[model samples]
Target: MPEPVVVDAMGGDHGPAETVGGAVLARREHGVPVVLVGRAGEIRAELARHGAVDEIDVVHAEEAVPMGERGTGGAASGASSLRVGCELLRQGAGSALVSAGSTGAVVSCAIRGVGRAPAVLRPALAIALPAVTGGATVLIDAGATSDPTPEMVAQFALLGASYARLVLGAADPSVGLLSIGAEPGKGNRLTRRVAELLPLLPLRFHGNVEGHDVLAGAVDVIVTDGFTGNVVLKNVEGAVRAVLTLVARSGTAAPEALREVARRYGPETHGGAVLLGLSGTVVVAHGSSRAATVARACAVAHDLAGGGVAARLRDHLTAEPVN
Candidate 1:
């Protein structure tokens, strides 16, 4: 049997009920074993309510990291659910860790607990966005390393390409530097420098791509610094929400075509971002995740772990000489 996914059951905005419910849903829908890490009593109560008390395991954690706490450097806090989840992964009790907690805390804890892959300067968060043409475009450095070095950005490209291949099944993923323009020298110094290093890697370099090209599927992977990638992700999410709201207000009830588009492209449906370059699979779900989103996240975590994402990343990175 595959190892279970460890979940920070108290990490989301909706509280333990939703988180636990999601875990149950994931087990039912995808047959993914999950170990809920949080206050045992609370988690048990929640599980009992769903009549799933015997279906999942519970590990006690006394506290949860707040959304504002940053720079913890992955220090293990016995009270923190996120820390406990990472610890479970480190101890080989679970194959992956899933948390809808503070992104910073999850990233920090995963790094400190599971450690980084060989030759990885910093880990990145990779999110797959549904593209207009078909398939998905992966955007890396979603918010992990805000001010990464040029070499770091180059590493992100390779990481993103590997992700596109493993998760999205892109035979030969095309990598593009996210910049102001499609020209080689369009972006700032960091992008320009990274652009020069991309072609030398064992990837299908597509040169520089603009922001619009992200959703247009111009490239399989779009690499950018964490700050810019985060901003772009939020903007795209907001745009999608705004359009859906406008359609609702117009009393059009959203045509089937538009509904299908929204369903495919929505962030909730994609589960959450995967933290690449870590020793184990770590999925950081949105803080506002509810039962459905949480379940989706668990499914993603299971797939990533079972698919050998970390090993593949390590092998690929180790084979390439760091610039």
Candidate 2:
């Protein structure tokens, strides 16, 4: 009964197979309305395989943005599934967009098509990663702006803090700058400069946090450039897998218990990283995502869109500005 979430069916590693199946799953299992945007024939065939051809709507697209594309090409092409899906969101034909396409391309297309919220210098990808304290740490610029200005990084902290408050329900969330050392004036020139600017802004700056503290729950929000944040995200996933595998082999924990822990941190459970500071909701999932991950991505988009998260986030940032 709600507006359908648009999915770029040809964007992921498994293409229409996983994406379309995910759309069907979101509609049938989660009761979320979905619209698949991709090649009409392939989408229908995949939907038919799930016996959902009649349930979900399909919008034909002539192209798909390649995984390597960095937004310009994806945004220029009117027929790419990424572009088409973004247009649907921009035009109000869809409530939100869920894509496993290149994060750069999705961010690029969303900005060009759906636009950014007023006064947003650059949009960011914020991911809520589980912490050891049972609360989540919101990592901003988690792959959206690999290289951003000092001011942009400062704003990322603002966005990350606001997200912690609105979504994670953290009151007065403490913010940390990701650095090599916990001391001030640590990390590269970018981080060093950011450290100097953080205290000047309206935030509960918690100084610097080292790599080991990312999951230590020392801070509610962690702000860094997209490149390092992406590396951190991948490293966390790999470490989780490796440690759990070793634990299973050691027989210290039950296999079922280990499986549950893995599932808790899996891509399917979290869906994907959200592109924040935009005018509309856009969720970018793993390029290698399968049906379950895609379905969860759609559900995430639905909830964020319905909750008026983008508007609320903009207001929050305005109330407590970075600059």
Q: Compute each candidate's TM-score over C-alphas.
A: 0.78, 0.73
Off by over 4 Å in 1: 49-55, 65-78, 102-105, 108-114, 237-270, 288-292, 318-323
On residues 253-291, what C-alpha lDDT tens digit does candidate 2 reach at each position?
Answer: 988889888876774244367887665678888888899
lDDT of each: 0.81, 0.82
Model 1 vs. true fold: TM: 0.78
Residue 297 error, candidate 2, Å: 1.0
In candidate 1, what are the lDDT values of residues 149-226, reduced to their tens digit? 987888888878878887788999999899998889788999999988888878899999898888998889999999
